[model samples]
Target: MSAAVTPRHARHTPGLLRSIYLPRTADALAFAMSTYGIPLLVLATTRSAALTGLAFALEWIPRLAAFGWAGSIVDRRGASVVFHLASLGRALVLAASAVLLRLHPSGTVASVTVMALAAITGVLTEFSYIAVETAGAAAGRRAGRRAHRVQAVLLGIDQTATLAGPTLAAVLLLAGLPPMLAAITVLSLLAALLALRTPPSPIAPARTPKGQTGVGLLTGWRTIRSLPALGWLVTGLTLSNLATGLLQAAGPVIVVKHFGQSTTDVGLVWSAAAGATLLSVTLCRFAIDRLGQWPVGAACAVIASLATLAAAQAPDYLSYLVLVAVLMAAEGGMTVVLRTLRSLVIPPEKFGSTLSATILILLLPFPVAGVLTALTPPDALGHVITACALLQGLGLALAFTRLRTDPALRT
Candidate 1:
């Protein structure tokens, strides 16, 4: 089941690119729909901020628990297979949820069932996401020296999906919850069909010696530990995610409470931020080519940290929106660089496991950020955000040094 290697000089064929991007874009759309729709539906039905928050948490917390094991499965069984299966499973879940919602529009049972379904979908989504990423990385490897360009294109596709998905969800929600769920179910099915079209990804042989074969869930963690530079990079990304988590947990409150913005205004601001992210990701390939990956990554980190800190002090809604846009742009560029580096460094066999482990680390602090947001006073939110930004800055500095010395990252 090992992947057949392509010649170095061969151009990245259109079919290959489509195989990688189409399914991923569909998955992103489905994800965005579920992420936005579930919370809005919960809030609209239950009229409780606490229940809405719970629904959101249910959609993410399971990812942490499933990451390691999912990665192991991707490695053993092949990413393409896992990707297709997960999408099919998500489609079924969404369809079932839609039917339930139609049957029982309002009740404690319906609400609990929705939350449970969201959690199950979350777990399946994580698996599909990891597998798709692994498959993309494998495709990039086949692109040879153009691998970074392929990565940038894929990242751009993802950013565009991010921009479109939420806006579509918002629009669809006005039509009502059942419509939204039905739309998501259709998207999930489309994603599954796209996955079926993807060519089989090259799989790496077992690392175990001949006549002995076994792999542990922690294999990904061990692989990261063995690579010092990757370890440092993941640590920096984890810190960056901590700052992002704080912003996510507190940004809405800051908008409504501090800026006195309406919910519509809040949505507009995020839409603007998403647009910025899309633009930045589209330009990432050129930036990496001109400046090198490490430098571009370091600059993005600095920019993100500064923008985040500055956002805490914005005097008006417009100023805050501008700062948030800048922050998201920088974060988007940084993510492309990090993902490119991950694809370049990790062995093909370990891609799924290592990436999942990385995501697990990234997600670890989000719950803590939510707790802090709940406990902190509105007046002190700025101080907390500034503190997180500073921590991110320090981690980025350390990561910059590590990258500069890393032989694998040298252009």
Candidate 2:
């Protein structure tokens, strides 16, 4: 009987994974198309860099703001319900935006319409993101001790979608904005349909802890504060992201000016880096099984820091490209470790809220890096990168030291 049950369990696992991955893939592709295509549309319609910049800001601002409410919704509703609603909402938004664009082909009206579309879609996207993340967390829990493997596979899918999404969007845009919008709408509806097939989450809804009145951002904050090890990890990752952000924001400028490479070469550099990251994420699962999350995480942090420092001082484009690949590779490994630990540690009741809060904190550095890059002279960008890298190394050292002694590790 036990042997029969084992085979049945094995048969069910693939169906479960497939149901989750399919919707995730479609949703991610739609998001990627919108993220890339929208800004381009704005620029092409208005031909003003200022308005284009505002469009970009509009998109991200709503996305960040929506995380709070989105998480709350995910906690109140089930992941499947929230995911379906969000995906369908996104489809409606895109279709409506396309109609609006057709009415107002090009002008201030069109610009405002696009910006509004960006903001609305941004919010909807965040809702779906939180829903999927909650679903993933539930799946991770079901995987027991091999949770990292599940996360690794999901991470790989995301990276692959991110790499492919923009290029696919660019191709669709060649025909016209309407075609691109239609494609996104189709993908979103497909995602909604696929969401119905996913296994229902085994986790319960948000529960107010003792002494807490209700679940909210305050509760999430308290949850993080209650988990010292998780707090340290978040802080360390935040610092590391600053360095990585600086590198990313400065990539185009450095590749073109510092290295005398073409703009197309900039894409090549990042494509290669992303490939390395994909490989690293795949390898991290096996590494964690052998060396454990703690040692693997520590090694990744060290490698990322060292690579960042080397990339800053790299004398030529080829060397810089290699170092960037190495940096991203290590970052990928660290991401798997952090995500696996987050699934294991954060309470199911608080997972959605805490995940949103932590993600918001992590994203804060990217805009700051962009601002710093825009203000500084090209020649001095390398110095800033080096400084951030050093800070990353120090912060990670401190965080890991605390983590090594934390009671959570023993658990």
Candidate 3:
């Protein structure tokens, strides 16, 4: 009876994983397309690095602001409802923006229109993100001791989307803007359709007092405190993102203005980086099983720091591109570590709220990075990248030291 049951259970696992992966893949690809495509559009229209950076800033500000409420909604409403609704909302917004852009092809009006879409979509993206993260965590919990494997698979899916999204978006952009916008809108609606098949949230709705929704965020805060290792990890990752964000926000400017590369080559750089990251994420599953999460995470941190510092002084586009790939590979490894740790440490009932708070904390530097990119001249981006790299190294060192010693972190 036990042996028969084991086989039966194995048969059902893939279906469950698919339920999560399919929708998540669609959603992530659409997001990645918009993320890179929007900045490219802004740069193409305005021909100003400053404006490109500002557009990047606009894209992230509302995302940061929405995390608190997005988390509360996910916790109270359940993941499926939040995920489906947010996906539909994003599709509608993109459709409207696409139509409006056709009317005003190029001008201040077009620029403002895209920027407004960026802000609105940013908020909707957060809601979907929080919902999917909650669902992923629930799946991880079901996997018990093998939860890290689930995280690795999910990270791999995300990297796969990243690998494809930019290249596809750039190709569509070549044909024209409408095609790219239509592609993103279609993917988003597909995500909504797939969301209907996802498993219902295992966490019971977090009961809040009447008009006391603020309690959700407060709980997230308290959960972070209760998990000191989580707090330290989030803090260190936040600092590391400053470097990554600066690199991302300045990528179009650096490639176009500094290296004299075409827009298509810009997409290729990220595609290559995402390929490296996907490989790294795959290797991480085996590495964690053998050497453990902390050791693996620490090694990735070292690699990312060294690679970033080197990239900042790269002598040519080829060397910079290679170094950036290395940096992102390391970043991917770190992400697997972070996600695995989160699933293991956070309490399930509070997972959605805590996840949101932690993501908000981690993303805090993105807007700052955008602002820095805007202010710094294109020629000086290298120096800014170098400075951010040093800070990332220092922060990671302190964070890992604390994490190693923290009683909450199980070996």
* Per-model CA lDDT versus the true structure: 0.78, 0.81, 0.81
In the range 97-186, model 2's lDDT, one tens digit per residue, is: 899889988887888888888788888988898887777766776777887887898788788888888888888878888988899999
Task: Give the Cα error of residue 64 in candidate 1, in Å.
Answer: 1.6
TM-score of each: 0.89, 0.91, 0.82
Q: Alpha-carbon error at 12 in model 3, in Å?
A: 13
For model 3, the local distance difference test gives 0.81
Please tell me which model should have the higher lDDT, number 2 or number 3: 2
Task: Specify the poorest-scoring 10-residue window by lDDT in model 3.
Answer: 3-12
Each prediction's number of clashing residue pairs: 1, 0, 0
Q: What is the overall TM-score of model 2 with all chains considered together?
A: 0.91
**Model 3 segments beyond 4 Å from truth?**
1-14, 38-57, 96-116, 176-178, 199-216, 249-268, 373-386, 405-411
Q: What C-alpha RMSD separates each model from the true structure? A: 3.7, 4.8, 5.7
lDDT of residue 110 for candidate 3: 87
The sequence of per-residue lDDT tens digits that candidate 1 reaches over residues 334-378 is: 787777777777776566777788777777888889898999999
- For candidate 2, the per-residue lDDT at 390 reads 98
lDDT at position 262, candidate 2: 98
Ranking by TM-score: 2, 1, 3
Between candidates 1 and 2, name the one with more favorable lDDT: 2
